[model samples]
Target: MNWKKAMTATVAISTCALLMSSTIWAHGYIEQPASRAYKGSNALGLNTNVGSAQYEPQSIEALKGYPSAGPTDGHIASGGVAGFGPLDDQTSTRWHKTDIKTGALKVQWKLTAQHATASWKYYITKQGWNPNEPLKRSTLQEIAVINDKGAKPAANVSHTINIPSDRSGYHVILGVWDISDTANAFYQVIDVNITGQGTGGTTPTTPTDPGQPSANAWSPSMIYVGGDTVSYDGKTYRAKWWTSGEMPGHSDVWELLAGLQ
Candidate 1:
């Protein structure tokens, strides 16, 4: 059996199946414009605070035991680049804060029901989206649990996510308390891409929007990705990738990466 040939074919097939749109560039890059809201910081920057709220709740390394060698998901040091970690529980009951002067976020994850009976839940918020005080019990935002894989619905499987039109933070949480008693109950990957738009109804000031050309816009020369593996600094750790087409549902084969053109 041609193992090498088989592996090459597998990757190609996976990429194709993951991306069905003709407009999406294969391994292209998207540039973030300068900010009209905040000065100095790139109009847009990607972030996933390690051990912070930005990470999927139950899927952290210490919790999931995924490999931590590279800048991919599950790598503690890699996440250091993006600041991936559990977040301090917010005291604010109804809202979280996000600095969207730059871009909005898309989070994707893979899930498997270890015991064939497990269930998962997800939520989103911003850095200041929440306040230290509680709100009317009904005002607290509820984390939506996704159980459909792919864009279409499936049985006992769920996937895909969309950011709220006005939410501050984006978050995903998975748990098997409803399915398995043991670990290794499921296999999945979590991917995220930060694009220059938010539910806040605002766009960057680039001459043209990213993935497009416009006048007086910051022509994106190139964007560099630095993560925990390259540097020990916790401030810049994060995994990077690219994407195209509409946002992916959790079960979809492809989750857009930041490097996507």
Candidate 2:
């Protein structure tokens, strides 16, 4: 092959390699106070089935506009990506909550790859939002927002977020690391114990009844007969008929029984 032809072939291969690596090596996640991805990661010696998220915690990269455009309501935790689906599973008991007090708290990010930053926004769940419910824009209120004006961030990016004093129990803090160089942004959810106590910052009893809201998770392969009930994303649903494989909320086979608890 001629020199120019060989150079073109080499460039094509390098471009393909770069694109593939970008998709896999995602960028960053909260490190201190343990974001969900870090809490259940294999590298941390933490053992929890978070799918690929356990292996690649920094990869929760998603679209940029968070409250308005990005990864819709029910899929915030996983950055609306299918590979990190386990992060979307909602349950107060499912994730490890970090003990935190309201006021000035330092949150740190573990960046595997740094990019030109647009902004770093922090939002906390609304005062009464259910811990078991999937995170939504309506359920969260912004606590802090910082823009770098498209400057590349340092290797270690830490922010001092002043949590609202009125919060209590288990609350999720959604952090969006906006990348100025790209259309995507990285997301991380920090399950914080506002009162710095137990799982909820207060002792709470586990519900015994399977019928209780969020007591049982919906499994796609599990067959359900008419009148059968189950929970998904903190909502209770009743099977309108013998249904299997179809998911609740997304299908007509399941009827909405009740809202989040």
Candidate 3:
């Protein structure tokens, strides 16, 4: 072939190769309620950028043997992958959380590339589980499991799961999407506040000024020092020490104040 024709042919082949590579790397992640990796309303007004490419970067293979098997205690939130350690950081202490009322909750996932899904399992932190520590299998209790079994999930797959009616306060919901054909599974961790309300529950109260503590639910990302106060789940708290990531109701860093009722 002539030199010009040969160059054109080479360019076409390269383009095809790039497209094929992108296709092979397609994977899924939780979108609604905003998984740690997803970007949208849940991420608004946060001081830190939760949309880190390293958290679940494209082309990164999923971790295998989840829940009981893969992803040791320290990396549980990040699916036992490198470069995602920040998601599990206990010191950074601030992750955006979605405020939800207790009851049937609909969770959704966005698949950049769809694969035959084996199943989707969701686990939430047990009531009273310490949020100041890294996530572990022991810290979570399985809440729902849906078996897809080789079914091709839509671009936006959704599942409705019941949240415990009695539980309240900040929690993490970990989602695992097991691939039917591959030995990998996609993992997503979502922060949520469970207010004691059934369906059509009361909306979360807007946050008040940073200087004045309002009835607004506490967020992990907010920094608190000695004497700083906040309200969570209808209870008020006074910080005893400098802390973050410690849920107001669950951590020792904050002391619940009496006579607030």
Candidate 4:
């Protein structure tokens, strides 16, 4: 082939490879509860023209791993990008919040690109957390974990989690979509205002007689082995594995028992 023809063919091949890579490795971000980037862009009723940049610019390098205890505080909302710096600024009026009560809540994600997933984990800021400061791993608590076992999600994946009854006021919820086959993961941060009673009415009153195996109240310091049951915030959970220091509503160690009386 002539030089010009060979160059043209090469460029065409490169372009095709780029397009295919983009399609197969498309990552995702939280759509429900309105993540900081989604909330800032037109996707969530904002006036910004973030367009195609919505998913692209907001994604971070996943090699750093999730729940890092370093300086990721500022990158909490944008998944570690300084360009989305405004998302890190909690005081910005442009950041909108979703109103939620401390009970069963549904969270969803929109995948611009899909990959085989390892798991989806959710974390929330502790009550009385400092909203004005950048988010730190220590300030948050893991609430729910869904293991997909490398299965690919649909364009949208929704998860329902029972929120801790004790949390109130404005809190940040972080969703991590860890990819099974790749080194990268997607991060999304959602701001929420927890309303209604905080941890007051969750547990129902049991009979005065103490002989019955009335629901056991969960405590972090308590160790739980499989089949051991406990109650927290009105719901009952059975341990899925042996664990201690893992809270009931938030950790995968305990599975909620939906219908046991």
- Give the runs in model 1 whose Cα sits over 4 Å from its true position: 1-106, 110-117, 126-128, 131-140, 148-158, 168-261
Candidate 2 lDDT at 197 equals 27
lDDT of 4 at 29: 71
Scored by CA lDDT, what does every candidate get? 0.26, 0.77, 0.68, 0.66
Error of 3 at 201 (Å): 14
TM-score of each: 0.25, 0.67, 0.63, 0.64
lDDT of 4: 0.66
Residues 1-261 of candidate 1: C-alpha lDDT, one tens digit per residue: 699999999999988876643222111111111111111113222322223223232232223222222223333222222323223222322122233322233323222212332333332333233234321122223333322121221122322334455433322222211222334222212212223445432212111222332212111232211110111111111212112221223213222233332
lDDT of each residue in 1-261, candidate 2, tens digit only: 599999999999999999889665678889987898888788674537888787788888888988888999889999888788888888888888888887777788878887878778889998889877887889989887765556566566666667777888889999999888889999999887888422212111221234453336889766544446788887788664435677889987777864444
Q: Model 2 lDDT vs. the true structure?
A: 0.77
Give the top-scoring candidate (lDDT).
2
Model 2, residue pairs in steric clash:
none
Candidate 2 scores a C-alpha RMSD against the true structure in Å of 19.2
Worst ten in a row by lDDT for model 1: 27-36
lDDT tens per residue, model 4, 1-261: 599999999999999999888656656777777776677665555525433435453354344367753237666665554455555666524457788888767777778777777777788888778787778887889887666666666666766666788787788888887888987777777878888653331112121232333457888776443446788887777765345677888977667665543
Assess the local accuracy of residue 214 in candidate 1 as a C-alpha lDDT between 0 and 100: 22
Model 3 has an lDDT value of 0.68
Q: Tens-digit lDDT track for model 3 on 21-56?
A: 855675776767876656322334342443343334
Q: Whose TM-score is greatest here?
A: 2
